[model samples]
Target: MSNKIKEREIQIERLQNNLSPIRKIAGWTAEVLGDKIGVTKQTISNLENKKTPMNFTQYIAIRSVLDYEISNNKENEVLPKVVALLLDCDDELDEADYSKVQDVVGTVAATAAGGTSTDKLDTVFDVLIKTLPFVVPIIGTIIGTSANWSKKLFK
Candidate 1:
């Protein structure tokens, strides 16, 4: 087999490993993600187990669903913890902090409503910058910012 093929296989294995935890973090069972991806539960399990390789289309579909859940807080079934944290100190918030919070909330809301466009890399960057004070680093890692989905978005 070609070295490029072998490297691609390794990358897919790594992606499968990473995807399992992200799916769990998003509160999605294999069955749930499978439904979203139009695949069977067994197929989802196989992918998660790294017993099967995911095609580019499957990766994109799964990433889209995960991104929606993260931005919308659907996984937690509540407002983002960052919002609650900001709210808890609302009385003491300075103008700057308040403005930052508002911007973050607006960005998240907009993204939830499908406000982001691939053509607008600036919008994505804006959202990322606004979310920096929150748990976005961890979230980004889980969702694989270096993955093809983000590369496509930034491209």
Candidate 2:
């Protein structure tokens, strides 16, 4: 209500948002974290702002609740639900979707340039390896160096 209180609330919200897994793992801020732990929204706010620490027992209780929920709903539930939204969206992927597939160009073009039919299909596979990072957005950077091998050989 007071200006200081409002500022703290905003800062707390930002802190929660900045957490990498707060959205992915917790399904957003102050969610089941509060409902299951018997902690109030205000208490969660204070935790996020570092005004107070999460008691060891409270952390155990809260984490157990979230872990149970996320683990039970992990792949079959969460992945499918997320995929459903992308699949059901009204906007169909345009040429932009192919952009993720762009790393294919050099390999395919090289194959074409070489004018070789022997192992020509390897281009598709090679390109797929190269394009895989861009295609798999989840851990793109992890596989980033993997693609560089192709650039070394090709270019």
Cα TM-score per model: 0.45, 0.34
Alpha-carbon error at 61 in model 1, in Å? 0.7
Q: Report the C-alpha lDDT of model 2 over 74-125, residue by residue, as the tens digit.
A: 4323222222112121133244653333334334434434544424433343
Model 1, span 74-131: residue lDDT tens: 4352232332222223234456755665555445444443533322423543455555
Q: Total clashing residue pairs per candidate?
A: 0, 0
| Model 1 steric clash pairs | none
Candidate 1, poorest ten consecutive residues by summed lDDT:
78-87
CA RMSD, predictions in order: 13.8, 18.7
lDDT, residue 14, model 1: 37
- Estimate candidate 1's alpha-carbon lDDT, on a 0 to 1 scale: 0.51
